[model samples]
Target: MQGLMQDWPLTVDKILDHAKAWHGGREIVSRSVEGPIVRTTYAEIHERAKRVSNALLGLGILPGDRVATLAWNTGRHIEAWYGIMGMGAVCHTLNPRLFAEQLVYIINHADDRIIITDLTFVPVLASIRDQIPGVKHIIVLSDEAHLDGSLPGALAYETLVENASADISWGGFDENTAAGLCYTSGTTGNPKGVLYSHRSNFLHTLVTMGSDVLGIKATDTVLPVVPMFHANAWGLTFSAPAVGAKLVMPGPKLDGASVHELLETEGVTFSAAVPTVWQMLLTHLRTSKGTLSTLKRVVIGGSAVPEAIVRGFRDEYGVDVTHAWGMTETSPLGTQATPNYAISQMDAEQQLQFKLKQGRAPLGIELKLVDDDDKPLPHDGTTFGRLKVAGPFVVGEYFRAEGGKILDQDGFFDTGDVATLDEHGVMQITDRAKDVIKSGGEWISSIEIENIAAGHPKAELAAVIGVVHPKWDERPLLLVKLKTGEAATKDEFLQFLDGKIAKWWMPDDVVFVDEIPLGATGKIDKKLIRERMKDYVLPPAAGVASGAVALAAPPEPKIYAPEPEPEPVVEPGHEDDAWLHWTPDAAQSVDRSRREAPAAPADHVEAPADAQLPFRGR
Candidate 1:
């Protein structure tokens, strides 16, 4: 027998309704694509969103119909999201960064009826209008005056809300009804849709607001630099409103200058974005001598956070950097690297090491690792395996059952990532399952190598791909893109990795290029790298031929081989203990020493600025 409780459905509309009633005056600032900043409160947005619901219904949008939105993170876009989901319609967010053909394919796949888009995307939508026959009407997220003649027969967004009634009912349907659709970046194949339910979204928003997660509070001002189309901007759109935190949406212009301007002008306290975007911001801050006085925390994900970025934010700027890990399939928040009580007791360097790994799973999520045979692996932190997750927010299957059954019999979904979870509950991603290098029956993590190479002062970007080797079966090839005015030789990089990593794990060769390929989601496109380097040949080593087999058995299980020599023993209460510990200064010293003799120039090729590279996985 269960205790009696209210049977209130956990619909997405309740989040807005509660915010409107309790925090109606909270501010929502947006950088408009129409050359102005628009400001509105939760109460005002709530009323306008209701009108949007009525307007959509008038356009024959049924409860289960999918309404696509090709827009940025603006006040109007937020209103469109609530308006579409509130009326039980599915909100399908289209990424503008994707190719035109990809957009057409997604639109056709979703069979969207009404598309609400920003003014900037009007021309793009117009170009593909003829191909997407399912789109019945196009609504421009602008005033009637801003509607271009080229977008024939499009309705103005403001006119719809201004002419509609604000009095409308919401949430009469089941909580499990589909509320939104977000497609993966389609690195491996055609983009697949992850249909999110109202229940899942509501649960996800709740978890993100918890102290151990995004830790959003009403007193905070959030700037989600991550695009709204990317996994619901990592779920900030819903969490911000649910907690009544002020929002500052940076639309269209995601460059360093624009982001810095908003962060300072709007008094942003917390923000989230990928590493590349943060790199630009850090560069801007250093060049301009700007300070992040108000900014407190930053969530870096979509790709691994570089060690330099973490140090720059934490050591130099006094800002907290949270290394988050997730994908579109997990409502985009599977794990976050927020410090815990156990971590607080450690030294600063130890804490940084722990924080560098993806933090523990929050209360609502369950994580596990398994070997190739689907057997459960121990949470020993050293044995890397395929990462699997199950939670209220994780996807059970793709939209329209595209990939068939995705979850195992035990209900856990494979994350397509290989990782290890320590006894302290911290999880660290070693590599993507397909990207891991198998050399002599042992695995080498490409991500670990790339991170170390990217941490170098002269290396602007780095990617590691496995090449064919006759002896070892596969060997890693290091690709590097130097800074604008910086240079480094292959020997310099190899020497830099001497004590930091195992000798056996070193790259067989280094090839310098002008730029490394980045995927649509701003991740290294290894698939394209492999295709480009398919014909690459490795140079001969000391004794083994380039293709000769070196070993028959895999080494004992270890993430990285032990250091060549053990540290000297220190007496009790000795001063050398402090020096022996890994400190930021020591790390910088090592980096500086490596650059002292780097005058040798290496042969490098330059690719055209507008190279037409294929987009690959996230």
Candidate 2:
């Protein structure tokens, strides 16, 4: 029998409503795209968001219409997000870092009716003006004074909000109505969109705000260096308001100095960003002799966290570096490295080992390890298998069914990741399913080798990929981007990994370069790296001794081929096996999207990292 309940739908608009009512005075700070720091209260932002909704309505936007935003993490951006979602319109966040072609593809695929963008993206939109045929109107997130008429017939965001009335009601539709749209980075293939419903996004916010996840409090000052366009700024956009926390939006300048200034000036107690951003912060602090006075915890993700970063924050600055693992799918909070009771009781060294692994998922999500044939694998901490996940927040299928039938027979979605699950429910990603190297008929983890090499003192960044070898099927090659003014020999780096990883997994060659490419999501971008290093030849005596000579080239290994046929379509006759059609009613019953990589060894447990950071005192 169904129990007696209030039947209150969990829509995202209520989050801002609750924030306005109970935490009206809470400040939402932002480094404006123009120049100064802008401040507004939750109540003010709430009213402004309503006005934005009315303005969107005046522009002919209706419920379920897609309103695109190509802006950064600012107060105005937040207003645009809420205004779109609260009015039952879909807020499709566009990644500014993506190429013109990619942006055009995404904007057209989404069929975005209107675009609310920052001034920085005006040129981008202008360049792609002829490409995105679906964009109806362009609204710049600026004021009248900032308008230069660079793009004629563009609307000013502030003027629109100021002129529009705030009398329209919000959120009358079903809770499962489409709320937001975020697309993957498409490192291997054309990007696919992840359509989020109000119910799933609301549920994700609650689960992310739990003590073991984000766990932010009202009194905390949260800074999101991760942009609003990136999987909902990793969900900080909603969580901050839901918990009444003060949000410090770091506009577009994510450089170390700018971020440090915000952390200090705003007294930010907690911040979340990718590893590269944190590394920059640490570098700026080291060079400038700056300190993090009020910063407490830093959540690092988007890629594996190097040991240097873990040590740089905790041992030097006394800030905890919380590693996280998720993709554009899973509402981007699949698993976090927050310590549980058993892990908390372990020694500091043991705890470090667990922390390095992508920690267990919280309630409302489930993880599984399976072999090649889709058979379940044991959580014995050593066996590598494909990672699959199932949950309300995980994507039931990609938007438009781009990748067709991602879920298996049991409805578990394959994450395209190879991982090992420990007995304590900890999971460590060994490599991307497409990245694990096959050498001498054995799988060599490029992630594990890259992680160890990156931990070297002089190394700034590192990437490992399989290369051609006559003796073995394929051999691992290490590419290093050393820190500024830092020099190292090949022997020094290879020796640094001595005894740390298996001998078979040792990189055959070390190539130094000035810079390593990072993707729009702040990942290493191995796909690009392989293309750049296509000419490098591995030394014949590689991994045997120092000063190995170059080997004769063999037929280039077939590994890392441009992601073959990633998009599989269903035949016209196979309607029964086709993905469920997306109707409003079908969408109400459906919730969840798909798709990351990580590093570390299985048999070995690492001790505490070196505490001697280049920075000053904690």
CA shift of 369, model 1, Å: 0.7
> Which regions of candidate 2 deviate over 4 angstroms?
543-618
TM-score of 1: 0.87
What would you estimate as the lDDT of candidate 1? 0.79
Q: Write down the RMSD of all candidates, one decimal each.
A: 12.8, 12.9
lDDT of 1 by residue, 353-396 (tens): 87777778887799989999999999898898999999999899
Evaluated against the true structure, the overall lDDT of model 2 is: 0.78
TM-scores, all models, native as reference = 0.87, 0.88
Candidate 2 similarity to native, TM-score: 0.88
For residues 1-618, could you state the per-residue lDDT of candidate 2 as single tens digits? Answer: 998999888899999999999999999999888879999999999999999999999999999899999887899998899999999999998876566677888999989999998988787788788787778899999998887888777899999999999887888889999999988877767888989999999999999899898889999999988777778877888999999999999886777888899999999999988777788888889999999999998887777788888988889899988877887778777788888888899998889877777788889889999999988999999899999989998888888899998899888988888889988888888888888898987888887889788899888888899988888978998877676567667778878998999888878877665445555566666775665456667766654333211111111111111113233333344334212222221111111111011110000000010000100000
User: For model 1, where is the 10-residue window of minimal lDDT?
Assistant: 607-616
